[model samples]
Target: MIAVGDKAPSFHLAASRDRVVDSGDLAGRPYLLYFYPKADTPGCTTQACGIQEALPQLGKLGLVVIGVSPDPVAQIDAFADKFNLEFPLASDPDHGLADAYGTWVEKKNYGRTYFGMERSSFLVGADGIVKNVWRKVKPEAHAVLVAEAASKL
Candidate 1:
């Protein structure tokens, strides 16, 4: 798993507007890279809204937020539009990036087990090194916690 001080894995994924968002594209800016299991789910929605609410504060700290999911581009566009999420939502359909970041794992639901992306977030500094990692995060207070981490970046 990627840890603090480790270089963030390079990626180039499809995003809203058919744009490609690459890790190298974020050079010279601190960024919040969050991974959620799916798009448009209740928990994911709440977490995204929280991040949207905190975007202003986070932007003041020079932090850019990017959310990733294994969902496709069409779904991501809908989710972003429905929630008015101003940040980029990257599509990771093959789970390459998630595996690279160690966010993909076996998950449990009601005694059933499956493989999916864990609710994880990473704070990547301008230098492209991970500053912090939050694994299996809870939706509530997630944005505030991420904001706090960005403040210290």
Candidate 2:
């Protein structure tokens, strides 16, 4: 997995049907790049909502939150709308970005094995270096933890 102090992987993906968010968009700004397994799921919803609720403080700290998931634009759109999520959520439907960041991995559940995104997050500093990383994150309280980290940045 990518670690703190490593340079973050560069990526460009669809944030919506018509909008694209790229690594360059995070230039000169500290940002949170989070990867969740799926959209509109219980855990993902909790994390997104927590971040949404903390936007004002995060904005004051000059941090931007960008979430990525292996879901299509339509599904991402629905999720954002349903939760009133203001942050941008880019789609990584092919797992390209997830793999690049090392968040894609093999897993076994209920005796079935498969490859999928592991819940993770990265705090990319304004210099484009990873300042912190969280792997296999618990959905609850994650946003709050990330927010505290952003404040320190």
Cα deviation of 150, candidate 1, in Å: 0.7
RMSD of each: 1.0, 1.0
lDDT digits (tens) for residues 43-127 of candidate 2: 9999889889989999999998889999999999989988888889999999998998999999999999999999999999999
Clashing pairs for predicted structure model 1, backbone only: none
TM-score, one value per model: 0.96, 0.96
Q: Name the Cα RMSD for model 2.
A: 1.0
Candidate 2 TM-score versus the reference: 0.96
Please, what are the lDDT tens digits per residue for candidate 1 over residues 1-153? Answer: 899999999999999666788888899989988999888999999999999999999999999899999999999999999999989999999999999999989988999999999999999999999999999899987998998889888
| Cα lDDT computed for each candidate against the true fold | 0.93, 0.91
Off by over 4 Å in 1: none
Scored by lDDT, model 1 comes in at: 0.93
